[model samples]
Target: MPTEPEPQRPPVGPAPARHELDAERLRAALVRGADPDAFYRRLDVVTETASTNADLLAAARDPGTDRRVLLAEFQHGGRGRHSRGWAGVPRAQVIVSVLLRMPGIDLADLGWLPLLAGTATVDAIRSVTGVDAELKWPNDVLVGGRKVAGILAEVAGTHPEPVVVVGIGLNVSLTEDELPVPTATSLALAGATDLDRTALAEALLRELARRWQQWYVAGWDVTGPAAAYRERCGTLGRRVRAVLPGDTELHGVAADIDEQGRIVITPDDGGEPIAVSAGDITHLRPVP
Candidate 1:
């Protein structure tokens, strides 16, 4: 029997910046197995919006604006997990941010939301790109040892009615030169050449919605998705250095994420165990 030839993929390059998509096409594409009006209600699509997270925050604070979804083709001022600036490849990247209303929940418990969003994104990317992406410590997705996606979750307002905004930035199709960092990659860069930004974005949102609903119903558990989160987390049992606020630094082996989702680190010096509530983690070794 003859072997079948592999499909030839396009060369690595930035996808063209599309100003807009036909409303009809967009409506049809976004309506898969979703509520008819659900897609219409939270679908805020823009050609050149600055940052979907920023826009979602502004709308969430407004009494008149309904809690909705924000999607931008490109983000001029997009930010990541620690206020880091991010660049998008126009139509090749997905810059989506969603707003959720959490009533009566303490602001602290919201830390795990980004992790959930990251896991959901991994599921979506795997389905669309056929690549098994891993999550870096807190919430960055890596493909073939290179960063391909990231999640940023921020909370606004105090108790009573708090608004949580989840921002997702993914590299669907970017060239090597356009990638901001050498350690970063795109779906196309890591042998997943069938990348589609719009399709990937919609899948991410749908999967994210599913995970969010589960988390909301289960109410934080050591099992469930959080347990699955630990399985795919790239930082587990790896030597790492964490830079905390006020220039304090801790070097250790990432033991695990506790039931509460705090990163548990065992110091390399064999001193004491430290739990980092929030900080930047640098895994000494590349993703394996």
Candidate 2:
């Protein structure tokens, strides 16, 4: 009767926490069901970095590096338009940067790159989270009038071929207390039930690639992309204040975005419409 010996059980600890994006899983998902020669030639997921943009920009200097994507689980020194710093919880956001070497594209059309990125971000967020995300001028992605994502495009190098690095930082599962500012919101906070970073990143990259191809094939034409951006831009037709460089300010109604991607504003003082190439926009509330 000694045949039935008690089986020894190994001790079990607490269950391992789940991550929104397993690096390997994310990499596999990005390449799966995608074209073999897709614009995203390489996908890298890092545990932490000063900035994915910085990493990709450095890689772009090699000349051999092109269409490389770098994603970070957490970014301690991330930045946005105007040198503003951005931070998000580890594994709770999609922080990515892409390197592109556009040799034949006209330099004049380079102005539209940020807007194109903004448009792609809006589309991806809307499709993935069911949130009506909109663009704020050149780079901010807003949902319900709060910033959920931001895009930054920088010219990395231009000696042999023009290399541009575009970075996108999207908040996914931060809680109310984790928000950097009152005007910031995350997808989870915005009521997105599916906070899957892998799916979100894939959707964003696909949209960006599609838009990039369209822009490239059109010889960097702004007509199509401009219209698409205007349709989803919440700044247009709203009263706003433009904090121009050097502390100059202009208060006006955001009339439209010109073909060059500048914000055309009709000054409130009845002055001529001014095209703002760069400025900080503040949406003004209507006076009672």
Candidate 3:
């Protein structure tokens, strides 16, 4: 009796060459139309780093270190919300962190920093690659419901002027197999035509700067960014499960984002709505 050939695995192909970032080209582009009074005073690109967020957080301890931008071609110790581990393919993602003084922002409103980063990143991805990216509440950026970027905002100083280090890790050229997890996607896998690191970095910084400047000028006003975030937030108007610290959970419909950037979840069982300041959220369904 003839038997079907033992199930064969797909043939493996050689991996593509790792693209190294051109710091000289990036620096030149950033300086050609440089704004003397821009929020970003200095932009530095590094070949590799333990963690750009940690480096910038340490820098923020010195008042003079405000307004500096640090980008790493690779992050060996990158992290996301809840200290989730992260790392990037060499020059395949925009791994950047920005340090800024709080500029008299209220403590309660600090949550918006990471949210703002998500919004900025989504917009940047769209602008640079023509890919439609959306936000997953506070920190994750998504393309077609799969994670594409993660944002982390750490508060450093807390005296005369509090400083924050906002780090963004965006997957630009990661192949499908290189995705951090099965639930994640990258611009490359999402069919983006432009994967140039310099162009993506420029777009990310520009969009981030524009949004940060607006929020800063308003003295940390949540009105504008909040509206913009709600618009881009895919979590809103969906059924979700909010998991707070210690594994506590609340199942409800994502109603609205409050002034302090908390996601308000209204329980479908006629229970009172609750606002979550920090937690993990799983999108369940679109609210009908």
Steric clash pairs (candidate 2): none
* Per-residue accuracy of model 1 over 1-288 as CA lDDT, tens digit each: 111232343466655444342334444555433456443244667878778888888787775444466777778988876678876767777778888776555566777788888888898898988998989878989886678888888876654566788888888767777888867877877777566666777688778777766766776443566787888897898788888888788888899898678899998779888988788877775233
Q: Model 2 residue 281 lDDT?
A: 90
lDDT of each: 0.74, 0.82, 0.81
Local error of candidate 3 at residue 159 (angstroms): 1.0
RMSD (Å) of each candidate, 1 decimal = 6.6, 12.7, 6.1
Estimate the overall C-alpha local distance difference test score of candidate 3.
0.81
lDDT of 3 by residue, 1-288 (tens): 121223222233333455777666656555434545445677889989999999988787677877788999888998888888877888778899988787788877888888888888888888889998999888799887788888889989778867889998888777767778867877777777788878888878778788988998887889999999999999998888888999988888899999989999998787998989888888875445
Clashes of 1: 0
Say which candidate scores most in lDDT.
2
Give the worst 10-residue stretch by lDDT in candidate 2. Answer: 1-10
Off by over 4 Å in 1: 1-40, 63-67, 220-223, 285-288
Worst 10 residues of 3 by lDDT: 1-10
lDDT of 2 by residue, 32-147 (tens): 33545556667888889999998987787686888888999899998877798877678878999999888786677777887898999999988988977898887899877788
- TM-score quality measure for candidate 2: 0.90
